[model samples]
Target: MVELSKARGSYVDPAPARVTVETWARDWLRSQSQLKPTTLVGYESALSKHIIPRWGRRSLSDIGYAEIQHWISDLSKNLAPQTVRNIYAVFSLVFSFAVRDGRLVRNPAEGIQLPRRIKAKRGYLTHAQVHRLADECGDSRTLVLFLAYTGLRWGEAAARRQRQSIPALRSLFMLSV
Candidate 1:
């Protein structure tokens, strides 16, 4: 058999050099400094406080979906649902960066099913109830009246003058029943 050293062109192993997930994440974090100050700070904080301690040292190529799921499950222990979702967002962004930079063939976070968000319950008032409330309310209740009628916020109404309009907000309020 040919000597191992003679078979390869260099003294180093012929296998592709390994880049760990942590290193790739760090490199991505460094790239964030060029973004908005608040954005860079947010990314850096997420990386240091959340992503690094959990996933920093693992080999990028070896981090499969199971590991990611377990990490999310672990996060669920102490974090609120929205906070966990934010963690998922950071992971997705990092993996997307890895894919764009050619450090990863595919983003492992792409298809990992995140926890479903609990939607707020919306309650509607009947026409009679609305009329009774409006009759009892004064001019100061105009904002709430508008929220019930034209469905505009106090800010939106406050922001409005005769010459200006919010087309999108108008469109949303005017949707067909």
Candidate 2:
């Protein structure tokens, strides 16, 4: 217990552990004004669909490694590895807030092993394949050829102005022939 001196006398109160996960989560979400709208939506979705349903009512001090591990394992059984990681990330963030507030000694969501994500293999197109794609695209052939030859991503290609890209494409065509 910590003591505080009042005007009349001293008062002692035990360390705080009464805050529930739901309460802390709400406060944490409300505090995230700098987050993007889409990111905020994702965090809210994860809390409502996963974390809140299972652990919302539990007191901050009552949650521990075992409980968190069990919850993650259960989620992994049905959800994709990335989805599981995202949901766990939300839980970890809320618990971290509790720890920072002195409601807990450590984050219970720390150090848990999660499912590994598998990356798909990328395929490269040959000259023949690029020619065929350009032929099929007809009027958009220049765009297709530019993408294949320059390796610019969709967003970068879309943002390119006609005057800027035409010279570059002509230079590339000169080099290729």
For each candidate, give its TM-score against the true structure: 0.60, 0.85
lDDT of 2 by residue, 1-177 (tens): 233334434332214656788888999999999999999999999999998889889887788899789889999999999999999999999988877776666788999888899686999988988888887997777778888977899999989898988777767765542
Each prediction's Cα lDDT score? Answer: 0.70, 0.83
Q: State each candidate's clash count.
A: 0, 0
lDDT of 1 at 159: 78
Instruction: Specify the highest-lDDT model's number.
Output: 2
Off by over 4 Å in 1: 1-23, 29-45, 123-139, 162-177
lDDT of 1 by residue, 42-95 (tens): 777777888888888876676788889888888878887777888788778888
lDDT value, candidate 2, whole model? 0.83
Question: Which window of ten consecutive residues has the lowest lDDT sum in model 1?
Answer: 9-18
